[model samples]
Target chain A: MISTTNESDPNPNESTLVEASPRRAWYRVDDFLAMGLAALIIVTATVSALLVRPPNIPQLVQDHQTSKVRLQQLDPSAESFSADRKKIIKQQAEIESSIATMPLKGWLVRPGEWKDDPRAAFVKSDKSIATPLLATFGVLLTLFAAVSFVQGQSAWRFALGFCGVFGLALFSYVLAGQEVVKHYNLEYALWAVLLGLLISNTIGTPKWLSQATRTEFYIKTGLVLLGAEVLFNKLLALGLPGVFVAWVVTPIVLVSTYLFGQYVLRIPSKSLNMVISADMSVCGVSAAVATAAACRAKKEELSLAIGLSLIFTVAMMVVQPFIVRASGMGEVIGGAWMGGTIDSTGAVAAAGELVGSVAKDVAATVKMIQNILIGVIAFAVAIYWVSFVEPRDDGSKPSVMEIWHRFPKFTLGFLLVSLILSVIQSQGIEGKSLVSSIVDGTTKSVREWMFCLAFVSIGLESNFREYRKMLASGKPVILYVCGQTLNLILSFLMAWLMFSKVFPNAASELLAK
Target chain B: MRFINTGVLKFACACAVVVAVWMLVLPVVGDFPSVRQRIEGNRAAGINPTAVFYTDHPAMADIERSIAAKVNAPTGSFWQFSARRPK
Candidate 1:
C-alpha cells in the first residue's frame, strides 16, 4: 500500500480533511469585501432610521419632486380629478397634530404649508444635512478599509482614495441641487457619471483608486436595498388593470425586443442584445444591470446601456410632460404610459408630477409594479442562459449546484427583504408606515448614495475608447432605439386598453378614492 | 455576413414581418372609442391647468424667490450672453 492515506488513494480520512479545509473559516477576498461593506451600510441605515427619531416633519407640497413647469401643463381639473386637495388638508392636519405631540415645535423644522397644495412652501431646514455627511464619511471610510483588507493591500491608501472619489461625487450632488439642474431633470446620477468621466479622461484615474472602484459591488448593494422599496402591496393599487398592463405587456415586449435585437439586428454579442432589450423593455438602467449580470454581460455593455438610458431619460423627462398635456390624455393613461416607458423611477415620478398629482401618483405606482418584475426577469434570464445559451460543449448539462453557484445571490437578498417588508405591510397601516419610514427616511438615502457611487465607479472604470468600440458598429444604438420605440408603442397600447376598456372602473375607483 | 446564416436570416425576416403586422394592428386595437372619449373629455373641459403660485404660503414664496435668486444671480451674465448668445 503506497501511501493509502493520501488523497489520491481516496482515503476516507484524507477526504474528510480535504472537505473540512475549505469550511475552516475560509472566505473569498472579493466576495467578503463587497458583502461585508454592503451588510454594514444596510444594517446601519435601517437601525439609524429606526432609533433616531427625527421630528415627525410632514412632507411639503414644495418638496414634491415634480417641477412647477410640468405641474402647469396638467389639466386644470387635475387638482380635482383625484383627492389632491383632501389629501393636502389631511396631511397638514396630521403634521400639525404630530407637532403638538412633540415636546418643542419651534426647534423642529416646521412643515410649512404649500401656498398651493402639493408645492413646497418653505426652505427645508438644513438640520439633517450634517448628519448625512458625517454618516457618509464614516461609512465610506469603513468600506474602503474593509475592501483594502480583503484585497490584501494598504488600507489607508485606499481609504484616502475613496475620500477623494466620494468628494467628487459629493460635489456633483451639490451641483445637481442647483434649481436649474433640478428643473431640467439633470439628476445627480448624470453629474456623477460626468465627473467620473472628466477625471478618468483628463487627469486619469490614479492606481490606488482602483481598489475602491468597484461598480458591481456598489450596484448590487444598492439593488438589494432597492428591493426593500419595491413593496409588493403597492402593485395592487391599480388592481387587475395594472397587473395586465405592467405584468402581461412587459414580458411580451421584453421577449419580442430581445428577439428583435438577436435576429433582426444580428448583434455580435447576445449579452449586449439582452442587456439592451431588458433595459428598454423593463425599468431602464436598473433592469439592464440585473439582466446583464444574469446573462453575464460585459462591463462595457452595461455602461453603454446605462449611457443610452440616461440620455433617453433626460429627453423623456423633458418632453413627455408636454406630450401628456398636448394629447389631453387623462392622468391615469398618461401616468401609466409614462411609468411603463420611462427608465428611471425618479424620472418617471418627475414626469408624472409634471402631468399632475393624479398622473404622478399613477405613474409612480405603475413604475413600482413594473419594478417588481426585475426579480422574475433575472431568474428567468439566468435559467435560460444556464440551460440553453451556455450549455456545455461536451453536451453535458450543468448540475443544479453549478447553476446555483453562478446565480446572482444579491437577487436573493433583494427578494428576502421584499418578502419581509411585504408581509409586514400586509398586517396594517402601522406596520406599513413603519416600513415606509425606515425605507424612506434612512435606507433610501443610503441607497441613493450607493447608486451615485456606482455610477461614478462606472465612469472611472469605463474607457471612452472601449465604449467607442462597442458603439462602432452602431448596432447597439439601433437595437436600443428600435426596441424603445417598440416599447413605447406597446406599453401605450396596453395602458390604454387596460385602463380604458378592461378596467375603466378600476381607474375611476382610484380617482374616487 | 459571416454570422448571418440561413436560419438567422429566416428568423430575422419572420420577426420583421411580425413587427410590421403588430405595428399595423396595434393602433386599430388601441383606438377604442372609450379612450378617445376620455381624452376628448379632458380637452373639451376648456381649462388649462396653470402652476400654483403659492401666494398663500409666504414661506413657500420665499423659497422660490431664493431659488430664483440663486439661479439668476449674475456672475458674468451680460458678457456671457453677448459672447454665447451673440444677440
Candidate 2:
C-alpha cells in the first residue's frame, strides 16, 4: 500500500515555520551551514596549497638528473636507446612497487601516493602545518553546527555531541578506505552507513546527537559542488563511438527498466525503481544519490539501491576481466564492455588495466563519457517526477508554477556549476591542466568531505526496520538484477558494435603507440 | 505571483550571487598561478603531483599489478563465489 500522494510532501510539516505561515525562510539554516562549510573547505585548501611550501636542494638535483637521463633514453634513432628505455621503465616500476608498501599516512596530503602521476600538478605539504589545519577545520565545523543546529536550545552539549558522532563517522570512513578495504571495493559510503547503523540501533542514538544529523542538507551541498566535476567537454574525448556506447545504450536501459518495474513487476515504490534503474544503467552510488534526491526518495530506498550496487559492482569488477580473457576479447572491446557496465569509475579503471594498458585507457575514457550523463539524467528525472508522477496521482495537471515549486532547487545549482565550468574550459582562459588542478585541489576534495558528512548523517538517522520493510517485497532486488542483466547485454552489444564494427580503424589508431 | 513566497525568491537570489561570484569573479581576480608554481616547485623537488583521475597517478601501476596478481593467478578465481562452492 504505497501512496504516490506522499511524493508531493515527503517531509511534510518538518519546516520550522508555522503551518499557515506565508513567509518561508529564504534559505533553511541547514542550507546556510552546509554552504558555509563547502566555502570554507575550498578557500582553505586552495589558499594553503597556493601559499605553503619548503625548498629541498638535494631532491631537486636528483630529479633534474633523472629527467636529463630520461630525455636521452627517449631518443629513438640512438642505438641501445630501446634497451635503455626498458631498463628505466623497469626501475621506475620497482620504485613504485616499494612505495606501495609504505603505511598510510594520518594526514590526507598524499604526496607519496601521487608523486609520479603526470596528469595534474601536485604540491608537497609542510607537515608542520597539518596540526593547525586539522584543528581549524574541527573548530569551524563544530561552531557551525552549534550556530545552525543548537542556536540557544541545548548550548555546548548539542555542539559537542555532534562533534563526537561526526568524528566517529569520519573514523569509520578512514578505516573503510584502508588499502585492504579499498582492494575489496568496500567504499566509504557503505562503511559510513554501517557504522552509523551499528551505533544507532544498538546503543540508541542520543537525542542531542540526532539533532546534528542533517542528511539532506549535507548531500545537497555536495551535489552542487559535484556539478563542477561533471564537465561536459570530457564527453567528446573518445569521439562518436564512445558516445554511442555510453549515451545510447544508457537511456535505453534506464527507460526500459523503469517501464518494466512499473508495468510488469508492479513495484510499489517508484523512487526505489528509478534509483535502481539509474544505478544499474548509468553509474552507482552517485546516480542513486542524484536520482533519489530528484524524486525525493526515502533514505531507506537510497540505502537499498546503494547496497545492491556495491555487491554487484564488486562481483562485476573481478568477473568481467576474467570473462574477457577466457573469451579472447581484445583490450579495447573488453575495456569498453567493462567500462559501460561496471558501476564505479575507479573499479572500472582497475579492471580495465588488469586486462592491459590499452584496455585501461579505453575503459577510463568510456567511463568519463558515461559520467557526463549524470547531469542530464538528474535534470530529466527531476522534471519527469514533478510534471508527471506527483500530478497524475493527485488527479490534476500541474501548472508551470506548481512544477517549478516542486522542482529540487539544488539541481539548479548542480547544472549551473557544470554549465559555468564547461564554459570556462571551452573559453580556454587557462590551460585544461589548470582547470583540472583547481577542481582536484579544491572542489573535488570538498565534495568528498561533504558526501562523507551526508552519509554519516544518513546512517545516524536511518532505521534498519525501514530497510527491512522496503526489502520485504523483494521487487527492488529483482528489479536491480533484471535491469543489470539488460545493462550488461545492451552495453556489450553497443560497445562491440561501435568499437569493433563501426570504428575499427579509429579503435586501432587510438590503441597504436 | 500572489502565491509566490519571498523566502524562495531570496534563496534563488542567494544562489545566483554565489554562482556568479564563484564562476565569473574568482577566475578574474584570484591567483591560480600561485598554486601552479607551488606544484611545479614540488615536482622539481622530486615529489609527484596529484592527479584527478586514478589512472593518471603512478598508483596506476600498483592497481594493475595488485589486481593482476589477484585476478590472473591460476588459483582462486571468480568461480569460488559460485552457487556451488569449489572443493
Instruction: Specify the highest-lDDT model's number.
Output: 2
> Could you give candidate 2's per-residue lDDT for residues A139-163 as a string of tens digits?
5466455545432334344455557
Q: Best by TM-score, which number?
A: 2
Off by over 4 Å in 2: A1-23, A29-136, A139-143, A146-158, A391-394, A429-431, B1-87
DockQ of structure 1: 0.02
Per-prediction CA RMSD (Å):
17.9, 15.9
The CAPRI classification for model 2 reads as incorrect
Rate residue B25 of model 1 by lDDT.
Answer: 42
After superposing candidate 1 on the true structure, give the runs of residues whose Cα lies further than 4 Å from its correct spot. A1-26, A29-40, A45-131, A391-395, A511-513, B1-87
Alpha carbon deviation, residue A155, candidate 1 (Å): 1.9
Candidate 1, residues A1-513, lDDT tens digits: the string is: 311221211111110000101211224333334445555655654555445443533342222223333333334346562344344334443432332222111221212211111123223452334444656567666765665565555566657667766776676665454333333344566667766765666555666565456566666667666666657765555566567778888888889888988888888888888888888778876687678767767666776787787778778876887898999877888888998888776567667766776676667666767877887787788778766777576888878876665556666666777778788767643354456555544555556667777777767766678778889999888887887788788888988887666544445534443
